[model samples]
Target chain A: MRNSFYTAGFSEVMHEVKQDPREASYIYTTTACNSPHRGLSAAIGPALFGTVKSVRALGVQLADSTGGDPDGPSPMDLALTGIASCGVTTLLGGGSARELIFDGIEMLIEYGAPDGEPGQAVRCRLSVDGVTDEPLMNELVEQMQTYSPNMATMIRPVPISFDCLVGTDESTRRQLTVEAEPITDRRPAACRVRWVSGTQLVSYPNGRRMLRVDQPKQLTGVDWGPNPQEYLLMGLAADVADQLGRVAYRLTGERHLWEVSTSACEDMRGLLLKERDVVFLQGVTCRVVVPETLRAETGVEKILTAALAQSEVRDLVSRSNPGGVSLVLGREG
Target chain B: MELNGRTAIGFEEGRSSSAKWFDDLTRVRFAGPVSAHHRLLPRELSPETLAVHAGTYEDPVTGCVGTPVFQTSTFLLDDASYSAFADGAMRDVPIYTRYGNPSQWAVQEKLAALEGSRSAIVTSSGMSATASTIFALTNAGSHIISAYDVYGGTYNLLREDMPSTGREVSFVDPNDLAAVRAAVRPETQLLFFETLTNPLLKAPPIGALAEIAREANALLVVDNTFLTPVNMRPIAHGADIVVHSATKYLAGHSDLTAGAVVGRRKFLDRIWAQTLRFGGTLEPLSCFLLERGMKTLALRVERQNANATEIARFLATHDRVAAVHHPEVGGPHYADLARDDYRGFGGVVSFEVRGGDDAALAFMGRLKIPYVATSLGGVESLVSMPSNTSHSSLTSGQRASIGIRPGLVRFSVGIENVRDLIDDLNDALNGE
Candidate 1:
């Protein structure tokens, strides 16, 4: 279809190279433990902690929660936050696209058990306001689960590649690459969850800067922000909470109050000592709670049950790794 | 009961203190690129003032009077960005340069203001804008109706590329409302036409085409590159989307190449998504240049309009000029519609030399003021013969069949002294 004349016309001898103009490849980068003041300097207050810088040079301090007391938010918190934010936003956008109107939406995340002990899984409680159409709310939940990128990343195995660049100087740079092992077990781990702590700065392709910090010395952070795990739990809660109100309303045709609580268990040995049998994150648990007014209603339990079943984040953590992470290490001299 | 407009959720009303953390998680930065930073002015003000002041991003931090170039490739992502990507609303937030940019936003705001549209999207080139709008609005197996005399690039896209992509196009005379109406297939998704066709200066009945499109449930997309918004805004005349080769009139200088699509927010969002996938996002520097160029759009187009009118009058009676084509020149072709819809005839005037292609080439070679160039709407005048340039893709027979003669020279008049331009034309036309 390059050039076809309706009538017979002279043809030119030419060779052309062409590709689909619409397809493109995007790349994201992050440098862990980079100096705080360097790059865009997104660091808050004194740069006493290790920070991570993205390719765009935006840097934020990292909180190490692997030992003793926590510092700030660890990396996992940010990941969870990403998932939650993605879920909520996806719901908002999808709702708008469908022209489904509603009111205030919020999610409450409960990481561990009420007694502050390691839980079986992460729990999230979702709540919504305004319109209550059980069917419409149900559809929205389905849409959010299907569309949310972070939720999808969690539920489906993501192909991740890690490259290690080790070097004392640019001239002495060397590279190492590693492929992640396949998971043979989908069952929950027998061991309890051991939290890993660290602070990090992540820059997205779209100029977004995020810094994760934890509580004071009690938790290991200076209270710059929520800890990494908090962010993750918060994200899961937000994701499930995004449409629960609508789901409840759609199911019962009456506005119902509810929230999402989520938790996750991890085995410290697998994360710290390279134990093949221990899963770093054993199981993620999620529960939905309704207000006292709706506790007696049979539909309340139905809606709550439906929400947990439909929770994208729960599916992400409960399932075995669906994708592989490949790591490549390189060093600069 | 109503939190914003709808009833507030009971649990969120007594939100826990930790709920504050969700602020960063659920915030949405911009509604979309164009309207997020738009500065409003009295619509009663002149287009010239709107061109200069509308869409100026007031820097609260530095109080910068003009839009500064946002040179970075990525913005600081937050919950808004995360949310935008989740819901197919990437156009609403600034995340990546390709997805959206503040610089692009500033220019888009200005363009939307000038076109009297609710939103606009800037692209790397005019063709990209056109292509994105077409591909986004219409699905595969859709049909399009356009003029036979549309710009050569557009003609090639429809004739050569569209069918292969599962879309069909029908070429017809835009003035023949009956033929245009008759050409609408049940699957016709759009009607594309130039407000002023290239070289020939043929004007389409936009209002009538819009009505036809309405009846057929099709969109009317007008390429308003030549007339621009200063002379005429096709959207006001019922065009659903108005596209421009900012490389030409909108940018007002040959220094940069850019494009714009202006219409409703819903349509612009879809077009923005298509443009993102097409990889035709305008760079920040180019966006800045375009914004700067458009500030003087009203002024530049006014001067070009006056000068082109004078040039057409001079050429109409000249001995070497066999025929002249301009909306203002006496002819029944689209005169009523032009007078009714256009505030001013555009800056381009197409005329035929007494001889054919060679004489026109010789006359162009004799010209001193205007450059021998392919594009129009620059501040500097440009002269090109259709046979040698824009319509070269068409065989002579095909060109003639479309009423483009051998000696048809398109004169894109610039802001030059009309008397000096007349003398230059006189000297060139003498060809002694």
Candidate 2:
């Protein structure tokens, strides 16, 4: 079902997270249907036409191609249809309590990457037939895309806004995060961390120091430390700086003092007390201030390449897919 | 109040003495106390008020209190919409991020309103804003006139890039009106000048330039980055278009970088078409930051202006400071021009150290509060040497010709407490 911020059931569903009596299976269901004579072998354009009894009445599936189907619907077209269909069904299902009507919802869905950027991005221009309350609808759409089971693994297509209003505290925390990059690999390579209530205890294998993390000052907490993103970016920058220094120094064999200033771009609007798929780092610009003689040296490119190659933080920052996420609350401090 | 008894003034039809106050009402605009009715028109509102509330809009989709950032690189267009757009039938829907999007449109709407223009386009950087305008406005064999003291990036573009593209540009002294007029040839297509030239703070007589542009049938373009719309709306002064490095005062928070081109829709549409080809589109995130930054533009500019003015006065009398380059101290003619054209002197205060480049760098390092960075127009103060930063592209002779000494420090005063900033300067300069 399509959930929207404005719809009546949106707030009801987004907030209502009651644990159901369901299986806690770490492994999701994996099975395959028997299809011997009816394999999806020949794909015509975006449409897939299979043999008799391939999958009963739903035997035909259209895959996307350059210029195959003139009249047939492409796979993406069907996907968009399914998404919209599910949304409409949900709205209809929640129509009674939500004071919503299901006359019909019109959605203009567009998807493409003109810049050849990663992922098939979607922009849906949705129009609900009857909704006077706009603020409620906006909030409903945000919640709908976030909490809906249908959108659980959709990578959250909702756009976000971020205010670049980092104060001294945030700046300091970001600095300290970058300072913690040295405990990677070698002796103190595999670090361990345990969560406690709103706090976290991180320890290294051979390092003398122990690290603690706390919630932001805005939240109800002691507010003892930097948030997760602060640590992530800090570590990444530190790693890059360390590797860059080593590479540059080694290449030149003469080390004059230099300064490296970096700025990371990110959007925090999606994190308005809720979670959505947000790109943490849009890009990073590093300006290095070296001595006049070496300022325009060709070693800069080589140094950057070596730095990118040697850092674990660089690897982590570059990857779109974090290995996974899990949550187990109510821990001891 | 006495009245003439012999004249047919009070008792005559349609000419009562009571209606004499109506003349005052007609002549006296925004003279008395302000009310709700007074704020209904743009003239009634103050420049500060315009910055706070002008160009704001409610989002149609979500009814968002602020503008929405459309992050997608491409918008979905049906076959009909695609064909329609292809055939030059312009639609409001965003087709491609490079071509145009809601994020850019949102910011552009605010900029156009602020600059007194029909439309505006924000770019990836100030140079792109400039290059795009120059390219779209002029082609091979076209002649352009500009100030020699223009921003270094612009100078470099004019000298290095435009030649390869077959455009001819002349760099002249914008302060000399006669020289400027003489330089404008029959082939001249554009007359460009900074609203307030950088580093030196030379105030250009924009209305005079507009007259010249008109006489020569040329378009006048002004870079209003230094004196933002809050100080002077170039469009109101008859300039054809206004450009800005939004990274400066408009963004206000040095965290983001952006540029803008604001003008009539006729020229703006041409620039937009070329912008798509240039692919200098600003993404959704930076656009959002800039829009948010502009929310406090009036508030920030007011404080910065006040602080910089105070600092400039302080520096002028200081024994350690060699020279102070600010509009107030930049000769009577320039000061008078500035006063006439701008509501406030900008936040930038350039000065020469007692010693040369070394002393400048040392002083920058000694400062405790202000950052020794290349950027400007943030809430926190910034100090940089133009020789090593903004104007480094120019040769020593070229820079010297424009009055950018090795000792010159372009100090961009922030919205900090003036007292604290002065103390910081005192300590840094004197080792106090």
TM-score (all chains, Cα) for each model? 0.56, 0.51
Candidate 1 chain A, which ten residues in sequence have the lowest lDDT sum? Answer: A8-17
What C-alpha lDDT, on a 0 to 100 scale, does residue B148 get in candidate 2?
Answer: 95
Tens-digit per-residue lDDT, B183-295, candidate 2: 97645778889998888888889998999987776789999999898889998898998999999999998888799999865467556666777988899889888888887
TM-score of chain B of 1: 0.92
Stretches off by above 4 angstroms in model 1 are A1-333, B1-38
Worst 10 residues of 2 chain B by lDDT: B24-33
Residue-wise lDDT of candidate 1 within B273-333, one digit each (tens)? 6798899999999999999999999999999999998899999999899999987777767
Give the chain B TM-score for each candidate.
0.92, 0.87
Off by over 4 Å in 2: A1-333, B1-45, B332-338
> TM-scores for chain A, candidates in order?
0.39, 0.38
lDDT of 2 by residue, A159-202 (tens): 11111111222332221112123222321122233223322223
